[model samples]
Target: MDKSPDAYWKATLRLIGTVLVIWFAVSYLAGIVFAPALNSIHLGGYPLGFWFAQQGSIYVFVALIFWYAKKMDDIDREFDVHED
Candidate 1:
């Protein structure tokens, strides 16, 4: 099956939008906005919120980077545009 450029681009854009939303929620909402509430929780003797602010988000970001690359490859293959 073949995909038009418009459809492929739309898929790419949607993937980007989804990744951005996830990144924002983890980095901003969890790390800062909800930090106070999350402070009640603990991980390895440190506040969960603090962990998120200092380290968790970075880990999540790196994971997302890999996930995004994998997803992009999948999308490219689906659209028959992937490099071999």
Candidate 2:
């Protein structure tokens, strides 16, 4: 069965919202709000908080890019809206 355009777009928007929330949490909450607590732990000689504030968020963002693509593909297939 195929979904209507409204349903497909609703799913797409939900996915985008989910991704954005995760992005914001990792970038802001972990990096800024919880930095002091995270700083207690160290990774590769750098404080974990510092790492998250600088590099971790970047890495997570890149991972999110691929994750979002894969998720979008799954959503497309589920809705029978896929290109192929």
Candidate 3:
């Protein structure tokens, strides 16, 4: 099946939006809104909430970057838009 450029761009944007939402939730909700409750749990030497704010979010963001790249590559292949 063939996909139009518009469809491909929309799919790409949807993937990006989903990734951003996950990033926002981890960086903001867990780090701020739910911090006190999460603080009860420990990770390594820090409270879980603090860890998310300081380190966990960064790790997740980096992982997401790789994940996004891989997904986009797959999407490009599916759309027959991938570079050789």
Candidate 4:
């Protein structure tokens, strides 16, 4: 079935919002709010909080982008709206 433009836009916006929420939660909240507790654990020469603040969140964001692209690609195919 072909989806309306509005449906596609809404789905895209929702996907963006969801990823942003998780991005902020892990990068800022987890790195700061739970820092003390997380500091007890070490990861790759850094504390967990430091890892999340620096590398982990960045990695997760990159992964999220690729995941979102793949997911939307599938969605577009499902809606028979994918561009070549």
For TM-score, the strongest prediction is 1
TM-score list, all predictions: 0.95, 0.91, 0.92, 0.79
Which pairs of residues collide in candidate 2? none
> Model 4, range 4-51, lDDT digits (tens) per residue?
888778887888888889888888887788877898999887899888
TM-score of 1: 0.95
lDDT string, candidate 3, 1-84, tens digits: 549998899889999999989998999999898999999999997899999989999999999999999999999998999998
Q: Which pairs clash (backbone N, Cα, C closer than 3 Å) in model 1?
A: none
lDDT of 1: 0.95
Residue 81's C-alpha lDDT in candidate 2? 74
Error of 4 at 21 (Å): 1.2
Worst 10 residues of 1 by lDDT: 1-10
Candidate 2 Cα errors over 4 Å, as ranges: none
Q: Write the per-residue lDDT of candidate 2 for residues 1-84, one digit (tens) a residue.
A: 548998899999999999999999999998999999999999999999899999999999999999999999999899877896
Shift of residue 12 alpha carbon in model 4, Å: 1.3
Candidate 2 has a TM-score of: 0.91
